[model samples]
Target: MSSEKKNKMPLGGIINKGGTCEDYDTGGWRKFRPILDKEKCIDCLICWAMCPDSAIIVEDGKMVGFNLDHCKGCGICDVECPDKVKAIAMIDEKVAKKG
Candidate 1:
C-alpha cells in the first residue's frame, strides 16, 4: 500500500485508536450482558481484571456493577469468574434490560 494509504489505515494497521475505546459507546453491539449475583460474588475481582471493555464498575474496592453504556456485553467476565462460583452470568440483552 502507498504511504498515504498506510497512514490512513491507522498506526500499526490497528483498526481503532487506543484511547478511543473509552470514548466510543460500543454497547449497541452487544447481544448479551452480564448479570451479577451480588450475593454470590466473592469480591475476587476476576471479572474486573479480565473484562476486555473495562465495563466492570468498582467502588471503594468493591465490585458495584457494570457501565452498560460502555459494556459491549462480551462474556469475558462470566468466563473469567471461577467455574464453581459463577458470580457473573451472561443473559440476553433484552431480558437483562427488562430486569
Candidate 2:
C-alpha cells in the first residue's frame, strides 16, 4: 500500500539514477553474439544505424568493432547488413566464449 512497496511487485527495481545504462553491463544477457567479417564488410555503416542498443562501433567513418558491454544480442545489426555482403553473422554466445 506504500509507494516504496508499490514498485516491488514482480521483476521490479527502482530507478535511482536518471540517464543512459552506461554503468550497467547488459551484454551477459545475450544468447547470441555477432561476429563481423572484415573482408566482406563494405563499411556502409548500415549496421551502426540499425542497432537498437547502439552496439555497433565505428571509427573514422568505418565499422571497426562492437560495443559488447551494451549490446543485448538483438541481432538487428546482422539483419540490417547488406544481403550481398552478409558481413555480420550471429553466433551462439556459448560457442563464441569457448574460443
Candidate 3:
C-alpha cells in the first residue's frame, strides 16, 4: 500500500475521535435486541458495564434502558446480567417489534 493510501484511514477504520458511533446509527445490522425487565433489575448496572457498544442507557447513576440506535444487538448486556439476577433478555428484532 502506498503511504498516501495507508494514512488515508486508521487501521480497521477505527477513528481516533471520541463518541464516534453516537453520531451515526449502526444498529441497523443487528438481529436481536435486549429487553429489560425493570422489575427484575436490581440497579446493579452490570449490563451497563459489560456493554461493548455502551448502549445501556444510564441516568443519575442508574440504568434506565437500552439505546437501540447504538446497541448493535450484541447481547453482551444480556449475557453480563448475573444469571441469578437476570434482568435482560435478548429477543429477535422482529419479535421485539411485534410484542
Candidate 4:
C-alpha cells in the first residue's frame, strides 16, 4: 500500500480521538415504572401481582402508586396487564436523563 493509503487506514484498529462508543452511564442503575392513564385502568391488579420487586401498591381500593426504588423496570407488569392499552411502561433511565 502507498504511504497515503496506509495513512488513511486506521493504525492498529485503535479508536481515534474523534471516535466515540455509545455512552452508558452506570451511575443510575435504578429503574422506574410509569403508571398508565387512569381512564384506561380497569381496576385489574395484574401489575400489582406481576411486579417481582413488589413495587406496586394498592390503596383505598385503587391502584395508587409504584415504588420506583425497588422497581427494576421489567416489562412483565406492562405485558401482563389485561387492558387493551398497556397501563404500565418501563422507562429507560438514560432517556429520562435527557429530559
Candidate 5:
C-alpha cells in the first residue's frame, strides 16, 4: 500500500496536523480534568502514550504533568493506567480549579 494509505486514520481523513495540537488551547472545553498525584505516580509514562491530544507533558523522558491548555478532558489516560496504580484521576474542573 502507498505510505499515505498505510498511515491513514481508521476513521478516515486528516482530522488535524500532527504534533501541532498545542497551538490551539482547548482548556475551556473541558468539564472534567485529569489531575496527577505525583506521590502515587510511578512515572511509567502510560498517560503520556495514551493521550490523544498530546496533552501529557514530559521532561527528560518522564511524565511530569498534563498540559491543560490542550487537553479536552478525554480521560483516556486515567482509563489506560493500570488498575492497581491509579496515578491519574479525573476530577471536576470547577472544584479542582476553585479559587
Candidate 6:
C-alpha cells in the first residue's frame, strides 16, 4: 500500500457568509419552558392554542417541544393549562441562571 494521508476539514472552518458560526454562544439569552407532565396534562389544548409565539408543538399524538427562543416567559401556557394542580409553571430567569 502507498503511504498517504487523508485531510479532514476543521469543524469550525465552515461559516455562514457573515463569517460567524451558527452555534455562537448566546450569553444566556435563551429561556427554558417548564415541560408538561403528560399523565397530568388532561389532553387539554389550552397551552397549545393560547401560546402567543406558537412555540408549543403537538406532533405524532404527543406534546413535543416548546420553542424557548421566542417564549419570553409570558406565563400564558402556565396559567391556561387548566390543571388544578398547575403542572405548567414559569421558571424565572434568576432560577435558570443558578441552575
The TM-score leader among the candidates is: 2
Determine the C-alpha RMSD for candidate 3 after optimal superposition of all C-alphas: 4.9
Q: Candidate 5 — number of clashing residue pairs?
A: 0
Q: Which residue segments of model 4 deviate by more than 4 Å?
A: 1-28, 97-99
Estimate, for each residue in 1-99, the C-alpha lDDT of model 4 and write its tens digit.
Answer: 476566566688977766252242322446644656677777688888887767677887688766655666776878888858676766776675575
* Distance from true location, Cα of 88 in model 2, Å: 0.2
Candidate 3 Cα errors over 4 Å, as ranges: 1-17
TM-score of each: 0.76, 0.80, 0.78, 0.58, 0.75, 0.56
Candidate 3, residues 1-99: lDDT per residue as tens digits? 576666466779777889776799978878998899989988898888888888889999888998888889988888889889899998899998888
Model 4, global lDDT: 0.67
lDDT of 5 by residue, 36-94 (tens): 88888888888888888888999998888988888999999999888888998999989
Question: Which 10-residue window in model 3 sums to the lowest lDDT?
Answer: 1-10
1 or 4, greater by lDDT:
1
Highest-lDDT candidate: 2
Query: Candidate 6 residues 4-83, lDDT tens each?
Result: 45565558886436725224433245454455666676656678899876667788656666666556566788888885
Task: Supply the TM-score for candidate 6.
Answer: 0.56
lDDT (tens digit, per residue) of candidate 2 on 41-86: 9999999988888888999999998998988999998898989999
Off by over 4 Å in 2: 1-18
Candidate 4, poorest ten consecutive residues by summed lDDT: 19-28
The TM-score, computed over Cα atoms with residue i paired to residue i, of candidate 1 is 0.76
Error of 6 at 28 (Å): 7.6
lDDT of 1: 0.86
lDDT of each: 0.86, 0.89, 0.86, 0.67, 0.85, 0.65
What root-mean-square deviation over C-alphas does model 6 reach? Answer: 9.2
